[model samples]
Target: MGTFKFSMKMLIRDYKKSLFYGLTLVFAVAVSFVFFNIINNNQLADQSIAVGGGTWQNVQTPFSSILSFLIICFCCFMIFFANNFFMTRKTTELAVMGMSGSGYINSTMYVLYQTFVLLALATPLGLLLGRLVIPCSNAYMYERLHISKDVNIIPQEAYIYSFLLVAIVLAMICVLTAGYLHRNDILVLLSQEKEMNFHGSSNKYKPLLYVAIYVFGIVMMFMNPHSPNAYIAPTLVGVIGVVGMIRYVLPDVIKHLKKGVFLTKRYRLISISNLSYSIQRSLLLFTLMTVSVTGMMAILAANQQNPREFVTSVIGYIVVVLLLVVSIVYKLIMEAVTRKTLFFNLWKIGYTRKELKKIVKQEVIMYYAILILIPLVYILFIAGRFIYYGDMTISFAVIFTSAYVIPVILSGFLTYFEYRNAVVKPIQGGK
Candidate 1:
């Protein structure tokens, strides 16, 4: 009991330090929930009206699945970074606890306590904020459409369930992180290495693959912008190709940092390194940006009173998807090149294979799920369906296909790389 109390106090202190990250995460989740609720509500109403009073609950499964994925993926990254931060700050303290009378169980309890308190604070507020936004957003949409909605936000249920779910998931991540720390090598805890090593480089021919994927995705996006289902296949293929190439290129690009052809080469190397890290650490962010931009274009295009209003919405979605496809492809190529450079630099700095693997694994996991999966699923299912049912076009169908398939492949590829880097590399080093 005393230990638990002490651990809870420590957890509070640590959580205070993590306030910035936690607050931002909570805000993002809240806003996303609100947006999702609005979109889901709109879709359900539309479908219900079409079916003449069919239950909205039937159509909610997909939306709920998407929400679950987002919460899990987001929490995973948050925990990874938070745990990493915690471990770095408390290595010596943890080491001392292990050496003294305190056991690993006591330490693990603290991790759980901290995670629970964080979620306890964050989830209710998120639900409340989401509840507040839904009504306002619905009012705007209703006024714009000049129609009334029969259904309204279930704030109470949403608040209770979502808060509980997210809390449990985050707490699980905390447990895993604590378990890892508890089993950490004493030597690693004693004098932890700063530098990270990586030995991979990019292939020159990879640019062609990236270009091909981008071009194909563009073609699909333009061919049938209105048909959401049609766009799925092309989007999938393009995304997969881009992810693979980026995975290959990102590490090397950071390694071969040299003066560019232009005269403004003073901070080029630093810029390149930072950009590379961002790409590797935040690929999901870039993807979300693309999805969000495209969605915005769709909404705006749909609203225009101009001559091309009808045509524009359809075209706008396609155009935005194409733009996203191109950006992702380009980023992948650049990231692959950058990673190669960074890996070589790490080697030069005498970072061990095991240490580098851990960093890369953490980074890859962070980028793949949070940046990629959550937004991709939301765009593909919720937004894709909206665009598809609204109008079926060849371009949209192609983009939708690409979007769906790409993330699955990317998830696998990134996971493989992460496992190879984190698990395999360490084992090989030990051998």
Candidate 2:
């Protein structure tokens, strides 16, 4: 009970973070409910476009399965990742509680309590949103897919399955929390802050090989629609190359930038120095987002040919973008919490709030640039051919731009605001 009170206080004090988590949880619940419901819709179960129908039903059938599987994996992974961050970030707080005579049991209870509360609030709201979204989706299907499948009653199995999924995620967090608290000593928790090396990656040979793969992959994209051996498309091969570029080539490139130009400017010096190392942490998530956005674009471009694919892809893209925003926001929020000391040191060393803010913005832009640039070149090459062939319009180029660009800018803005709240204003107040 005492731990519960402390947890409640933490939740209320950090209501902004709670709210962000709540929004994400709500989305997970809502999307799960909607997806399970749609995937099991009785009317749409037996029909296939192979028989003589529209293209959408076929795409929807397989794509939703793929999409839902991805969603489950995505949500589960985020929950697990966030939980890990939660435990690590709260290490110091837990250490303090230990000093106050709170045992591991109490500390574990405290974290679990807060997580449970957030999940409790999110589950019901998400269900409501799921219920509301059905009608909207039905309307879309009628207009775009040329079919009507009214969701008069939400399937009981869907409700049960969605509820079970969240419960499982919640249970997994509880177990992981208990395990972390039980396994680590106070020293281990305290030492975590010193773990990340600020000097950044320092390898050279990796970039040469990865750059070759990057070039080879791009060339293959133009040459082969499908690989002869594995039957994988060159686009996928190109995505793999992009991953190598980030995981390898980027750090080496920055080492040069540091020597030539970026080191000359204070803000650029800080941003560039940090970015290469930061790329290591961000590479996987950024790759996933890039793939999702790229896949979303491919599906959307197909909409010109298959109207069914358009509307459904639009719905899926909206969800993808929303998830992308929340996940990045979560990353930024977690970084701010962990890097408070680094920012505070910068303040004492001679950086002002204004300058620190600029540095933060620069870092955000560099991240966005790395994320978009490779994907942009590939998209433009394919889209140019499509447009010339009269398969796609110029208007779609505008849409593709907005789709990839807007949400990133939005996440950047949110990250900046959160940084000030988490790191800057507190320092200013202390001063």
Candidate 3:
């Protein structure tokens, strides 16, 4: 009990580290719960039975199945990713604890305690939110499909599925924590915060891997099987491409920016130099931004390709929008947190708050441009096909323009506000 209390206190002290991760779990759980209900609703089944399994039922079965599968895969990936981030943040603290004579068992127990504490808080909140939102989503779907069936807000099966999801997440957290702890010794953990020579050793092979993954994705998309399985190849391609870009391309791009004419400007020089030094973390933020843009672009492409699939297209748009918003907000918050000290130093070196804000704004715009441009080009290539087929319409033009423009504007405002609140305010307060 004492140990649990201590762990809770530690979590509170570093709440930023867990905030987004816990929220991510809650979001994932809620989404999965909604999806599970949609898949297993008794009312839906009864309707199907009454209609003797007509087109609606036939369509609903495969649609719901695909949705559920996607939701499950998303939840699993999110759980693993969130835990990895959480554990990475804790590496230095765990190392310190180990140096202070904490045993291996103690470290393991602490990780477990922290994981369960977060789960305990997030699971119920997620379930409740899911219950509240599912009805609205169902209503939207039914309206889009011109279905007269009443939407159930809470299904009994949702509770069961939600609990099962929690269990699975808990198990995954345990496994990931165990694996992370096993891999790094106290020395490695302690040194993680310091400069490491081996950090760029694998840079040479990264481009090869990146090219291979992109090629694989292109091949998969071209193969284009008629079944749902066809999506797997393209999806894998996207995931691998995003990961490889983050791991290799983004950092390399930043490192090379140091040689440009922009280096003549002091703020640009400083920001680029700082970014180059912390390329790994910078790449993570860029990766999130790239993924969000890519996702939104992909969703827009699909919607444009099949305008008649109203419900599916709407759902895809909603999911991608949520993903983009969350990823951008998360990246901003992380940037603020991680760069707090750097901002402070810049202030000490005679930079005003407004100047610092401009620097951040510039950096964000640069990142956004790079991250968004590639996806935009690819999406344009896809849209060109629709144009060739005479499928480009004013409605799609409107939707595409709004989707693309609104988010970019929102991202700029978000970055500015985040810099002011998280970075500038904190530094000013410290003074």
Candidate 4:
């Protein structure tokens, strides 16, 4: 009883951390519920619509097995990655408790209970959200797809399969956690974050290789955007390139920016110092976000000419991007909280509160610049295509840009406030 109680207490104490990563599980299960619902429903899957004015007809909309599979695969990875991230922090604390005479058994139990809490939090909410989302566009879906049948019945498999996915993720987390706790290497495992010496990778040829892959993937995606294998494959490749470039090429770019005349401002250098690490950690996350939004953007561009399909694409864009925004907001909040120590150290070094505020603002802007601008450029390029081909109006380009930017702007606001509360004000209060 005492052991379980202690575990529960630890979880509650760090509930913010739990909640931050819980967004991942919620999204994971939600995507599962959604994709499974679509996949299991024959009418929704087979419905056909028209495309290309008075030309080749018999076109269909975006929902397909390949897209579903890609989404499911991506969600699975998100769950696994989130699990590892949570346990990496949690187990280290558990090891400390063990050192304080709490025993290894208690440590193990905490891992179990933590996973249970995640399962409990993610399953029902994800399913409920997913169930709700299916009907959001359904009324128009039949009209858009030109189908007579309602196809409005929610699939039972969405609930069953969503829970099943959550279960599998929980199981994997436990197995992985068990292996780590057994080895007892918690404290020494990931001290790289503590160490600040980052000698940018010496390999010059490899970064070019990543850029080449990035260009190739982007080009391939535009060339054959309709083919499922082509779209999903290039996206996978592009993500690798984006992640690799962020991990490898970006550091080198930052190093040059710091030395070059472009970043001559002294204050900006402080932002650079902080950005160097945060961006590195954000590699896969921002890249994955790019894929999610851009995938929907591709649909938007392809369907820009059709009114119904365009509406469908916009709704799809909102759903996919907003799901990611939830994760991004949680992430920004957590970063502010976690980097409190770094901010305090800056405060101790004779940096005033105003300067600290500037640093926070600079970091937030720079983060958005990197996170939003890359994808925005790509999205704009996508929007530009329809304009060039005469399938879309300039206003649609504005609409496309607006859809992606609005949530990002809102996110930037949230990031600023969280940083103030978690880092800036606390420092002012002499903590």
lDDT of each: 0.50, 0.71, 0.65, 0.70
Q: Each prediction's Cα RMSD? A: 12.3, 4.1, 4.7, 5.3
Model 1 lDDT at residue 147 = 58
Q: Cα deviation in Å at residue 364, candidate 4?
A: 1.0
- Judged by whole-model lDDT over C-alpha atoms, candidate 1 comes out at 0.50
Instruction: Give candidate 2 misplaced runs (Cα > 4 Å).
Output: 46-61, 98-106, 148-153, 193-196, 199-202, 226-232, 302-309, 337-341, 385-391, 420-424, 427-431
Worst 10 residues of 4 by lDDT: 48-57
lDDT, candidate 4, 40-128, per-residue tens: 65455533322223211233434454456566767787677667667655655775676677766677777788778777987888887
TM-score between model 4 and native: 0.81
Native-to-model Cα distance after best TM-score fit, residue 213 in candidate 1, in Å: 3.7
Best by lDDT: 2
**Candidate 3 minimal-lDDT segment of 10 residues:** 304-313
lDDT winner, 1 or 4 = 4
In model 2, the worst 10-residue window by lDDT is 225-234
Over 1-431, each residue of candidate 2 has an lDDT whose tens digit, in order, gives 78889889987887755565677778888887877765655444424553365544454455545555566567667667656765666787777788789998899998888889889998999999999997777566555655655646666877998889998998898889999989988888777744665554567677787777767755765665421221135457667877888876887788788888877898998877666766677776777776777666666665555554455567677777778767776766666666677778899999988888888778877876776676677677666656765767889877876877787778877777876677766785544
User: What TM-score fits each model?
Assistant: 0.54, 0.84, 0.79, 0.81
How far residue 154's Cα lies from its native spot in candidate 2, in Å, is: 3.0
What is the descending lDDT order? 2, 4, 3, 1
